[model samples]
Target: MPRWHPAILLALASLQLACTLLLLASEQGGRARRFLAALFTSEEDGPFDYSHPVDVYTNLSAGLESMGGKSMRDPVFLSPCPVVSPLLVGPISVQLSGPVNLSIISRRNPWVLLGGRHSPPRCRARHSCAVVIPHRNRELHLALLLYHLHPILQRQQLHYAIYIIQQAGNQTFNRAKLMNVGFKEAMRDEEWDCIFFHDVDLIPENDRNLYVCADGPKHMAAAMDKFGYKVLLAGMKISRPSIRLGRYKMIKHKHDAGNAANPNRFTMLAQTRRIWRLEGMNTLNYRRLSREQLPLYTNITVDIGPSEKAPARRLHG
Candidate 1:
């Protein structure tokens, strides 16, 4: 091989010198310092002294406390509603319930025990929430949903009430219209800070997922067990006070004939989005009745569903 060029050699020497200076500077602090210290320093130069009668027991105890126990800075735990913390657990399986099981649950947790339209007295919840369920011929599913949801909501320390807006008649199910009606009706009864449009088939698995609202619209059912713990856009839409990540079990059911491969599904969704942007909750032309003490389970029949008399084109409007 030909002799190496003198200029190249000088450049290489300069690079080495620069690298040495960088390594020296890296020893000052931060991650680079730690890495360089680990790489270059010997065991003798390390901070720990293995020979100096190491208080292994004391150190181990401290380490354990740091890892497993809460510190003084930690917030006080509220009964039924534990202090909110970052969610570390993943999606879990949930056992489904029938009407009989629900009736048993209802007996055990009567309107008085269930707090009716309010939360437990001991729970100083942060937000007053409304869980609106737009329903039609899904009583069994509704019962199951109520059985599981109340406990989770209570544990989350949310002052929440559940409303079941059932659609009457054999007309095509208008989910969006029912949702709008639920919002209006729930608001009429109580000054809910957060409104959750919940589907009757979905049940939350973890209580750590707080029911409190956020700054914007929140999609609660991100990771669902039905979709192999994948993020989904189904179930529960939060307005104003939105929400974040939460897992739920979506009970599978037979698709309605009206919803079977309905080509207008996307169009309806798009129209709703547009209408929400334009009018929001004010678009509906219903008179707000005076506030009433809504019971634990109250059914208000409204002409909110799609009308069979009206033309099919005006259904979305």
Candidate 2:
């Protein structure tokens, strides 16, 4: 051995002593105390990349050193090796406070975050409602509805999300089935108190009508512009004012597109019973027309199908 071997041994012992003293000082109640205790309890450890001899090989070593009162007294605890930052995770509230960014989970890590948070929907809330439209060859109608109805909904500020459930098929538009799918998907995936089993083509001209079925199953379209806005039926309005119609647009129907007998629509000409009552107007007075009744109505069905030039003539202003 070389003559300096004894000095090297002494230096190593001094370094160990310094590390011990430094770790003893960090016994205070905090992250240091917790980490130090955990270190003493663990048996195995992982390999680390240390820059210098003073740099601790493990968090346990660093923690013990941190407890020590004097950093210089114990170089190992005083000099910390960098550690990786752990993920900061928690659930987020989606009450529609403002704009939000939506990101899909990656294929590699598709484990849902608090997945399937939807609850069994109830008929409670009136304003914070959800409206659904099952789509097909109604592209033109969907655009019109979004252009006009979205602003109306935003104005209402109803904790709402507009869902356009497009059927993935090549057959005729399965409006009813699409609605059913939308209802299931929306309710199963989110916390919507109610829904609007809405139609794509039936775009309500007046935002006042808005597609909400809060009261009994409401037929929004009573006198649509399609039939020249003629009183095909009258006094057709939501039963319980603007706030109450059907719970979640519960007025669902079979997906038949026969124009003549399609009871699902809001013609009001024959199916006046389904047409919701507004301001307690009787069937007789409902058939009667008045200019003042426009605003009080909580629901107005849009004329989705091809229409006569009546509405155009009326809007000459």
Candidate 3:
């Protein structure tokens, strides 16, 4: 056996240490990347070279709850962004902490505009998306959702904006009605290519779960941690292929007070075909109370009126 020189042994040990640090940094996200960058500064190969400031809207506070800003329509990129985004950070470990400060999040994710709008700077996005969330009294849930979701969306390289349609005055919290209102309002603002009716508490654990719409209306929350990695649709059976796609991590919380299970669900299910035409988006009636354009999202508070007048009358006949 040949004896190795001291210099060769020392070099081999240093190479092994460097390799180990790189593996660790890949899993640990930004903090570990910063440390790695400090240790391994170079002219052409560092994380800082790839890191660029996200392009956000400059004058977002110029108009009336202005969801349709001139900035969104402005010509930015020539080439279409890749379907499989290169900027993805893979699996995310979400934080279920208390109310998060928006200012801190804004600094962290500079790509998102005043109305939670983000568009990829390097390439034209394939899907122009609007995420409508029905909210009532779940302020903490909303804050946490925004905290995790913004970064994920940015990494996905999507042209997306988040809309929070808040219900005004307590009236048993009609989630479906709020969603109808959200759809109507979002469409009125812009002709979005796709829209996602997202639940406020469903935080995605992976950035691979794209928010873009499919050929049909897609159910996003297929596998959730709350249901032991089962489909969130409860009794409705799903295909194995789809179940593999829509995995999410939900924030743990007790049942909300106002959002009790509908007693008329069974009755309504039976008469769904009979009243299907008259019931849905056509019968949506809500009075807009206020609109506020915040740094992260657009909050539109609305009075959905009494439940008796909810399914008032059909548009035709």
Q: Which candidate has the top score in TM-score?
A: 3
Mind sharing the TM-score for model 3? 0.68
Q: Residue-wise lDDT of candidate 1 within 1-317, one digit each (tens)? A: 88999999999999998986786676454666556656765432333322332111123223223333323212234343335522222222355744435556555343223324544344345677888888887877877777666645644445678777766666667666777888888787779998888888887755545567776566667653221111123233333211222556688899786534445655644455334344435656443332333334556666643432321344554
Clashes of each: 1, 21, 0
Clashes of 3: 0
* Candidate 3 ranges beyond 4 A from true positions: 1-73, 224-241, 308-317
Alpha-carbon lDDT of model 1: 0.55
- Best first by lDDT, ranked: 3, 1, 2
- Every candidate's lDDT: 0.55, 0.37, 0.68
- Per-prediction TM-score, please? 0.57, 0.33, 0.68
Q: Write candidate 2's Cα lDDT for 46-66 as tens digits.
A: 111122211011232233234
- Which residue pairs in candidate 3 have backbone atoms (N, alpha carbon, C) closer than 3 angstroms, thus clashing? none
Output the worst ten-in-a-row residue range by lDDT, candidate 1: 225-234
User: Model 1, 151: alpha-carbon shift in Å?
Assistant: 0.8
**How does residue 9 of candidate 3 score in lDDT?**
100
Candidate 3 lDDT = 0.68
lDDT of 3 by residue, 120-225 (tens): 6556778888899999888888888888888777667688889999988767787878888888888887899888888898877656667776755556777542
